[model samples]
Target: MLLALDAMGGDRAPQEPCRGAVRACESLPDLEVALVGDGKRLEPLLAEVSSNVRSRLHVVHTEEYITMEDSPSVSMRRKRNSSLRLALDMVRGKEAAGCVSAGNTGAIVAGGVLVLGRIAGIDRPGLGVPILSLSRTSLLIDVGATVRCKPVNLVQFALMGSIYMRCLAGVPEPSVALLSNGEEDIKGDDVISEAREILKASSLNFVGYVEGKDVPVGKTDVVVCDGYTGNVLLKFGEGLGEGVFGLMKEEIRRSFLPKIGLAFMWPMLRQLHTRFDYEKQGGTPLLGVEGTVIKAHGRSKARAIDNALRVARQFVLQRGVETIREEVAKGGM
Candidate 1:
């Protein structure tokens, strides 16, 4: 399978994505990566890769790129030749099975809709991010993709999230829940209430209501909410993960015994820390789009980008796009 990559997407630019493409090619022999960026800059990095892996690398040069500061709508309108846009175009044109970008989230979402287009039954695409909970991972949909959503939109998000968890994350009979202020069905606003009723009536494994605290407790496999709430929850979870480690470090430095204790449990601590690391997941998928589009973190390193490509490849292999279309159609609006 061929996957197009925005080599100039992240903070590290061509270097990280280029290195990632090389690593992915080395690991997956059947995969080819199209690095879209300025040829002059990417050529040297491409050369650094081993000859066998380098053979799988193809450069699709683009003089322009969308910066993190660029507005999604404006960038989509003006920067037609941007590396991100070109990478997405490859997916749209069927030159590549999928695309990966660590660029501006807005631009990536905009490009997915404008370039790759949305599924026939989808209202707007939602970003599905997997959040690590105590027992298992939960799929959080609309994590900053569409901030304001209608009841029907949340219904679609739930369906997409369920499909994603089942197909990609290997969760059978994934339970879906609406994110709310309380676990009670009577506790949410009109949108959540409407969505809850719809989901309860559908064939999905609807688990009623779930609160913010329930997320990390693994109360449900899929949590459906508007992008506004989803984004806040996701960021809060990320911050909490970092803050906990920071607190541990500060406490360890405060006392000699704590430091010594940490040394004894270093391996276990490291393993726990790895679970909270966002880079390990690499990126989140823009679900409901016609093609497989992964939006990696803006500060993604080579390892993160490599994993992002792996996500795209896995999505393609599972036929995620077609599966969503079929499922969404079956569920209806």
Candidate 2:
């Protein structure tokens, strides 16, 4: 299957994205990539890949690029030859199975809806951020995809999240939860309460309320919330994870015995740290769209971009786009 990549869209631009594309071509034999960007800059990096990989690599040149700071509409209105626009066009045209980008998250998302269009019956698409935790990796939907959402939007988010976790992450009967301030049903505002009722009555394995603290605990596979609350909770969780590790490092260095103790438990600590490293998940999948679009941070590295392509590959073979669309057609919305 063809995977379209935005080579000139990230902070590191062609180098990091091209390096990652090269990695995917070399390691994943079943996949071919279309490097959408300036061919002159990408040719050298493509040469570094093995001959077998080089054969699988394809280049689609475009003079324009969607800059990180450029408004999403600017690309839509003016930059017709932009790599980002053309890469999306390939997906809409069915020339590629899916698309992956570590650059221009907003533009990629906007282009997904505008270019490829959303799956019919879907109210709004969600940014499916896979939350890697100690016990298991769960998904947080609407994590900055839509700043505001109706109660029905949260319900669809729960449905899409559960389907993603079960199919891609290999979790069955994945527990679903409504992200809220308290475990009690009456804690949040009307939207949360309405979503709770909708989810609880549904066929999913709804496990009731999941507070912010329950996210890293890995108690549920899906946590649905409006984009605003989800973003705040996500950032807060990331800060907490960093803060805990920082405090532990300081304490470990404070005394001789502590340092020795940390050294003894270093492997375990390292494993725990790697579990929630954030980049390990690589990128967030923009779910509910007809085509797949994985959005990575603007400051992504080669390894992260590599993982993102791996994700797109999995999405294609898993037939997640078809599955989610079918599920939605069954009155999921």
Candidate 3:
């Protein structure tokens, strides 16, 4: 399968993305990547790759690119030939199966809606990220796609999140819950309360309200919330994990006994670290868009880029978009 990649999107840009494309091509035999960026910069980086891998890495040069600080609407309107825009264009034109970018989240969402259009019955596209919980990896939707959402939007997010977990994550029947201040049915604002009722009435395996504490222990397979809440929770979890690890490292360095303890506990700690690492998780899918679009972290490097491409490949291979369309249609929304 051919995938379009924004080679100039991330903090490391060109170099890391180029290396990642080569690595992805090497690992996935049937996969090909069209690196959309300045060909001059990207071509040199591919020189060391084997001929087989090099052959699969195609470069579609574009001088323009959207910056992290650029306004989403302004970027969409102005940067017509940017690497980000071109990559999405490839997907819209069917030149590539999907697109992956570690660029501006706002720009990607804006461009995805404007260029690729929304799937039938999807009011707005919700971004879903798979976060590692104690028992399982839970999918959190609307991590920054739509800040203000209606009751119907949350319900639609739950549907899409459930479909994503079932199809891509291989969950048999994903349990769904709304992220709220409390677990009581009466908790949350008007939107969440109304959404909870609607979800309970639907055919989904709705688990009612889930407090913020419930998310880390795998209380539900899918957690739904407005983008504002979801984004704050996602960032806080990331920061907390890093702060905890940093403290542990500092404590280990301060005393000899802790150093010896670290030697004994290194394997388990490393495993836990990997579980929470964003690099390993790669990109999050922008669900409800017309095509498969994986949004990698803006600070992503080579390994993260490689995994993000793999994610896009899996979404296409699993026929995720088609399944979502079918499921949403069945809901009569």
Scored by lDDT, the top model is: 3
Ranking of all predicted structures according to lDDT, beginning with the best and ending with the worst: 3, 1, 2
**Candidate 3 C-alpha error for residue 288, in Å:** 0.5
231-265 per-residue lDDT for model 2 (tens digits) = 77777766777999999888877767878788789
Taking all chains together, the TM-score of candidate 3 against the true structure is 0.96
Each prediction's Cα lDDT score? Answer: 0.88, 0.83, 0.90
Q: TM-score for every candidate vs. truth?
A: 0.95, 0.90, 0.96
Clashes of 3: 0
lDDT of 3 at 194: 94
In candidate 2, list every pair of residues with a backbone clash: none
Kindly indicate the candidate among 2 and 3 with the higher TM-score: 3
Model 2 local distance difference test score: 0.83
Error of 3 at 253 (Å): 1.6
Error of 2 at 151 (Å): 1.4
On lDDT, the stronger of 2 and 3 is 3
Cα lDDT for residue 295, model 1?
89
